[model samples]
Target: MKYLKTRFQWIRWAVHIGALLPLVVLIVDALSNHLTFNPIQAATQRTGDTAIILLGLSLACSPISTYLNWKDAVRLRRTLGLYTFIYAAIHLWLFVGADYGYQFNYIVPEFLQKYYLWVGLPAFIILLALAATSFRGAMRWLGKRWKRLHRLIYLGAILAMLHLALVIKGDALRLSGDAWKPLLAGIIIGTLLILRVPRLRRALLSLRHKPVAPAAVQLASPPAESTLVKN
Candidate 1:
């Protein structure tokens, strides 16, 4: 592929594999019937985790390219974002169909009780809007509004993180394997936001430039401005 020749081709491919790996593992877990003791919970949890992480990665692509100057990164953002939506859709479907048995009567009561469910719905809705407009045609149609709309990803990420943190039955900060998941996810989301800061993005991108040694060496010190004015 011509696009493969772009700089950081290896990284793009690496990301592709990394994005899909979770799905592979999930599928394996499903086939082996080892997802969890509660199949519905397992499917919903795994899918939600996959979707959130993918969305985080999609959010990261811009900052990563801004820092690395890998133009190809822009191309991968849509792919990663679409994959995030796929996983999210499945997560929702499993929750509705398998977990609640398509019974909104039960889900509505749970939704009313759980704070996380309240927070997560908005994030999921934002994800829905983003995915709907992810295509090039939508990008063209929306123009400037597209950027503003897609920027909601940050808000979505924040809500998603809070949803997970609050949804945990026990202390998420506990010293355990599961405890680390939300913590690490928050760290990742925070770091990506930091990278997006204008000054920080410029500073990080500046590192890619090597000092122009020939320009420095070829130049001689100039006389003071006062000297030139006198002449």
Candidate 2:
């Protein structure tokens, strides 16, 4: 029991520290001159990837907590989700500022004419809205409506995966790029979605119904004390 509690504490601390590591890596790489590749593109890709990862991680929370019996760890799921939004916002800024130069002339045409842009742009828009309402304050303010709003992330995830798939296939010869990454991401997302099926749900419920042993409780015995007051 003590070990479990300590491990939980460690996980919380680790996650807090890990949250800063991505930004730190970016800054350190820039300072060390190791970030020579297109900085904006790199940032954008990392941000988008991180966002998807967070969404998947958040979705995994319920299954994971159930399996591990670690309900206390559920708070980390929300933290992971917010981190996704952080990276997503960074990705969007880099795309607009670096690629479009904050200019409407170039950006406007792409959104109107490009097919992939139609998918990716709307995905980003939905992400923006979701991120805006991610805070606890917004959750309380919106009450039950917040749930409906947040469900938008599901659509965002689908579009993001599709957009990435389209982008990767855009250049077949550029196999050295993110071709496989998107494919792998899509597969993972698909698996997670499949696990949510009603049949699968019933199967999992049956499995969980199996009997399990209770944990042993450890208690320290109190020290004995003798007194002469009885004499």
Candidate 3:
């Protein structure tokens, strides 16, 4: 158990580093002009992509933990989810602020004009709701309802993938990099949903917490000689 604890501690730190790597790469790319001629598009794409990936990973935390029996993985879920929202906020800001020049009036007309905006909007709302209730105090206040509220994450994941699918170009079966991104994300979201079904959740949770068999201890068997034991 101690060994497991130590390993998870290291893994948690590693996850933290891994989660931040996207931001670091984005910064370097922006400064180096590696994002290409259209930095806004590249920035938005990269940020949006990272947000979706993080959101999916956060959503996967429970199923993965249950599947792999890594109970401690729950500790990282909140962190990953929060980062997911942060990236999402950045993604929205880039579009609303930088792309549209902060024209509040344009927000609605634009959503009406663009189908992808509608799909992304609901997912963003769900992300906001989850983020608002994510803290310890909110968890304590919400109690059992906390779990129910967080279940909205699955819906958010679906809508996010839908938004991606709507925005991406090229044939779904194409070998190009951008063509496959949404399909891969969709598959991940679908797997998570399957693992989240009630029957599967219970089965995985049961396996996750099931106790291991104890090692046999060597002892002499003197049952006949010690027959007076319980008499």
Candidate 4:
């Protein structure tokens, strides 16, 4: 158990580094003026993509724990979820602050014109709530209700995928243009959700715990027994 704890600690640190690396790269790129023709747009898209990827990872924790019997994976959920929110917040800020100069007039008009913007709003709100109540204190305060609230992450994931599908320059239904990203995201998210089903999860757990059959042992020749009788 101590070894497991130490291993989990290492994994946690790795996750921390992995999660923050994208933001660091983004900042470095911005500093070096390497964010392509539209820096703000590039930053916004990158941050949003990172957030969705983290969110998918967070959602994967339970399935991984069940299927692989890696209990440590569940512990990483909160960390991943928090990172998802961090990137999501940054993504939104880039949209409203960097892209629109934090001008409500311009932001509101864009929101009204863009269906994807409003579609993503609820996902961000859900992430905000989950992040706010992610601590031990909040867990204690919410008790059983905390889980119910956090489950909304799945809904948020769905909305986020829709937002991505809409924002990209393609028809998701027709599978053309830049639709592959969101389609892939949807498939992954859908698989994660399916794995969370109680029956499937229980089946996976059973498979993990199932005992292996022992090999049958064969006896040697009876000639040895005749020699032992002489004693």
Candidate 5:
């Protein structure tokens, strides 16, 4: 039992390190002047990308647990989710605080003009709510409502993908320019959501646990040996 506990702790620490590695790299790059000409834009894009990637990973935990029977993945979901929120918050700050100098007049006008911002803001808000209620106390206080509220993550992911697609320079429908990232994200997110379907999940579980049939034994060799011995 002690060994198992130690192993689990190691796994959690590994996940933490892996999740934070991007942020560490980002900071190092920024300090070293590695972020390109428009550092703010680069930072914002990186943070946003990391946030969505983490969110997708968090969403994957359930399917991983169900299909691969890796219950440890479920335990990592909250950690991944919180990291997603952290990255998202940083992305928001980079846009509003660093990029716009926290000027609402500029930010509000841009938010009104940009359709992507419309969706992105809501997605961020959803993540904010989720992050706020992710604590043990909130889980206990909300009871059944906690689960229902968390389900909004799926919606948030959808909106996030849309925001990403819309932010691309070229047409997303035509799969041009930077559309590939969001398109790929959409495919992965869609598959994950499909895996969550009750019927599909049950089918996958049944297939995973289905027993293999034993091979038929060949008895002809035994009879042949007996005949040769008798002769």
Candidate 6:
């Protein structure tokens, strides 16, 4: 109980600190003119990469905790997921406001007509919905549906990869087309996900359920009445 209480306190502090620190850095960078590269692309990439990293972290928490034999690490998953949404929202905002110049007339049509836009915009939309409904309140309200909706994360990842691929394809391509970065990332993420397969899950469960030796089993289980002492 003491550990749990301390963990909760830590979680609250971490959430507040994590949520605010990025905005502070972004502001400082902007004001200090340290935003040296193409500010728009730089910001967008930072936000997007943060989102991907957070999402990966969120996905990793469970497997990590299980392997490490610690239940405490599982507590941070919701916070990680929320941060992912935060970054994803910032990424989408940067794309629309800075990259698109906030011209809906041009933005809407280009987003609708262009193949890359089609790939990315759908991902943003899904992430928006997931982020909006990430709270305990929303989870309770959605009940069984919450999990179903969040399953779209995989789809979002795929779409985001496609978006990145299409964007890079438009850039200067060497003979190789420079396709490996997004592809490799996608493969890593996808492999992490594939570890959740039900057959593999059952096999793992069966392995865990392996019977103990007779001596240990005797130690754990109640002895027979004949082996007990009346005294």
For residues 47-118, write the lDDT of model 3, one tens digit per residue.
Answer: 999998998888788876767656787888999999999899988988999778899798878888988888
User: lDDT for each of the candidates?
Assistant: 0.80, 0.70, 0.84, 0.88, 0.88, 0.73
Q: Output the better candidate (3/4) by TM-score.
A: 4
Candidate 3 lDDT (Cα, 0 to 1): 0.84
- Report the C-alpha lDDT of model 4 over 155-219, residue by residue, as the tens digit: 99999998998899888779899889999999999999999889987776665454534331124
Candidates ranked, most accurate by lDDT first: 5, 4, 3, 1, 6, 2
Q: List where candidate 2 sits over 4 angstroms from the true fold.
A: 1-5, 169-177, 210-231
CA-only RMSD, every prediction: 7.7, 10.8, 8.6, 8.9, 8.4, 8.0
| Candidate 2 lowest-lDDT run of ten | 222-231
Q: Judged by lDDT, which candidate is best?
A: 5
- List pairs with backbone clashes in candidate 5: none
Candidate 5 lDDT by residue in tens digits, 1-231: 346445988889988998999999999999999999999999999999999899899999999777765667789999999999999999999999999999998998899899999999999999999999999999999999999999999899999999988887777778788889998999999899889989988886665554534331234345654443332
Candidate with best TM-score? 5
Q: What is the TM-score of each candidate against the true structure?
A: 0.80, 0.77, 0.82, 0.86, 0.87, 0.74
Residue 132 alpha-carbon offset, candidate 6, angstroms: 2.1
User: TM-score-based ranking, best first?
Assistant: 5, 4, 3, 1, 2, 6
Shift in Å, residue 182, candidate 6: 1.8
How does residue 179 of candidate 1 score in lDDT?
67
Superposition error at 200 for model 1 (Å): 2.5
- Give a tens-digit lDDT track for model 6, residues 1-231: 447556876766876687658777887897888777677787776677667767777777676565444566678777887787788888888987878878899888877788978888898888789888988899999999999998887788778777767765433344256466566667767775776677876676555565657776657755552233211
How far off is residue 102 in model 2, in Å?
0.2
Q: Which stretches of candidate 3 lie over 4 Å from their true place?
A: 1-4, 173-177, 202-231
True-structure lDDT of candidate 4:
0.88
TM-score, candidate number 4: 0.86
